[model samples]
Target: MSAAAGAEAWGLAGLASNDPGDIHFDIVLRGYDREQVDERLRFLGDELATAEQALAAARERTAGLEEELASARGELERRVPDPDVGFGNRVEKILRLAEEEAAEIRQRAGTRPRRSSSRPGPRPSSSTPCAMMSSSGCVAPRTCSTSTSTRPGSPTDSRGGSPERRVAWSPRTGED
Candidate 1:
């Protein structure tokens, strides 16, 4: 051991090792043994030496922890941008730019003239006949059933109403 630690140990060794742990007392009707209380002095001798050693060890551990905490703080400083130099403002500027782009896109979408819908909308409800389901690839609505439109001649729905609602016009095969 170092000279200072050796000297401190030697000093503690010289003091009486008697402490509360070795002492005993009987539970009497009155109170504790007065002699035992006087002899141990409520954990004085060995406890003092042990407490000193524990305190010294704790101080060393605390010093190491303090050093580690300081090092972590230094590492954090290196990673983070300093608030003084536009850090918050830079983030706000980027968000503002994104918002402006979104607004411009919305305006462009709104300004463009919408084309009229040529796509067929939804079919009539199930109660009404849909022309497409007939065997001739869309017979007239009047002849909605596949069996009813089995008339084997025309390529088009001659009883045409709306073109989309009419029977599909394909080249009539010689067999038909």
Candidate 2:
């Protein structure tokens, strides 16, 4: 029944009827423990009320945590890049660029004059030797021994100062 209907039907009369002393019992050879039964009922009612309060508090906490979780998910969605749109577009653009570069390289190779021998040329005296990875073709090392810095982008002189000349080289394939 609705709260309004129940309130109209039953007032505070039920509260007065729960008196332990007024409870009726049939007389038998052995009588029931009325006092213990009354005490247990009171204890159980108190425990049920406490449990109901605890349930309400727990429900409120769960609602707050759920709201927090939703907001966190929203923030994460805003910050992180969409893999379908951004990543795929970037990959497609990179592939297109790489294809165009390959086409240009092939065109240049077709027009360029071929060398008679596949053997490596004589190494220059002033240049130092540096090894490349085994999977790729050999590279002619054009590093300067007098230079203080061997690292790329930063050219240095013998005294560990900035150098005027920059050493540069291209890798030649071992194949004909």
Candidate 3:
């Protein structure tokens, strides 16, 4: 007998014992194939295994990238100069010069001749200029000055107060 006929015969035999409803037997026999179901289940299991392997490979790749990034950062830390020693020195000298000039200005404020202006009230020329010089005798156009009178608390703090003071001794490839 054909597969469908065999299933129908089995269903009819079962119904004889239990007196199950005809609709129930029909529903049970329809669209039921044990072998085909088993094959589909195996296919799904194989797909799950493949997906797990891919997930594992992706995790490994992510870990490798993290390690590489850590190594690169370490290398960068080693190569970069300490800003506290290099740029910090230049900034400190500029600040000292500014303070001295401000003090001199305050002292001479009483006696020195002032520029006469037609505009009413004290029209203060707010432009303050400071010069910065490098070790190689190159003078920077702009200078650094702090309005506060207090000196830097620490050598590290002198360099913008950053804990990681990575200053390049010489200009980098792309930097001006």
Candidate 4:
């Protein structure tokens, strides 16, 4: 099935039952990058779960508010007796219609197919040279060293494969 259709069908229950081991990828020398793919899938699953929970909470809150409104209306009707058959009769009719409409709305909301917005993939870190460097100049490797420090010769992140500080070296001049 298409991803949109699958998403529509899969609720929290389906997601809970899904076994990551059941997933199969085309095998080459190393298959797909297992770690990266798994991490992205895990992130997507988490986002889906969060969205589902939010929807459920919103539904519960709405149901509570509807019940409260009905109760308040009932209490108001009981405390104030309708002496006049004209104004009170019209008000009563309107309330009855409103209640019916609310019931219909609730029914439709319950039966309608739910659609969750798809979240975009994880973004590349801005601290990376590939992301920060201007497109007009050199294209650095994505795995290039990254550091949060503002000054030159600052310590790079652990992922850069170097324990030493990253020096700002000019490729042409070979000077730091």
Computed on alpha carbons, the lDDT of every model, listed in order, comes to 0.48, 0.50, 0.49, 0.50
Question: TM-score: which candidate is best?
Answer: 3
Task: Residues 1-176, candidate 2: write the lDDT tens digits.
Answer: 43223323544222223466654444456785454344445544765787899999999999999999999999999999888899899677666655765587569659988432222222233444433322244323233332222233222323333323234443433441
In angstroms, what RMSD does candidate 3 have relative to the true structure? 19.6
**What is the lDDT for 60 in model 4?**
100
Error of 3 at 93 (Å): 10
Better of 1 and 3 by lDDT: 3
RMSD of each: 18.8, 16.6, 19.6, 45.3
Candidate 4 residues lying further than 4 Å off, grouped into runs, are: 1-28, 83-176
Residue pairs clashing in model 2 are none
**Model 1: per-residue Cα lDDT over 1-176, one tens digit each:** 53233324544221234453543465466797564444344346446677899999999999999999999999999998778666788677666655765587569659987332233342332222333222334322332211112122223334332323223333333453
Clashing pairs in 4: none
Question: TM-scores of the models, in the given order?
Answer: 0.28, 0.35, 0.36, 0.31
Tell me the spans in candidate 3 whose CA falls farther than 4 Å from its real position: 1-31, 88-176
Q: What local lDDT does model 3 show for residue 5?
A: 40
- Write down the lDDT that model 3 would get: 0.49
Q: Is candidate 1 or candidate 4 better by lDDT?
A: 4
Backbone clash total, candidate 1: 1
lDDT of model 1, residue 155: 33
**Candidate 1: clashing pairs of residues:** 138-167
Error of 3 at 78 (Å): 1.8
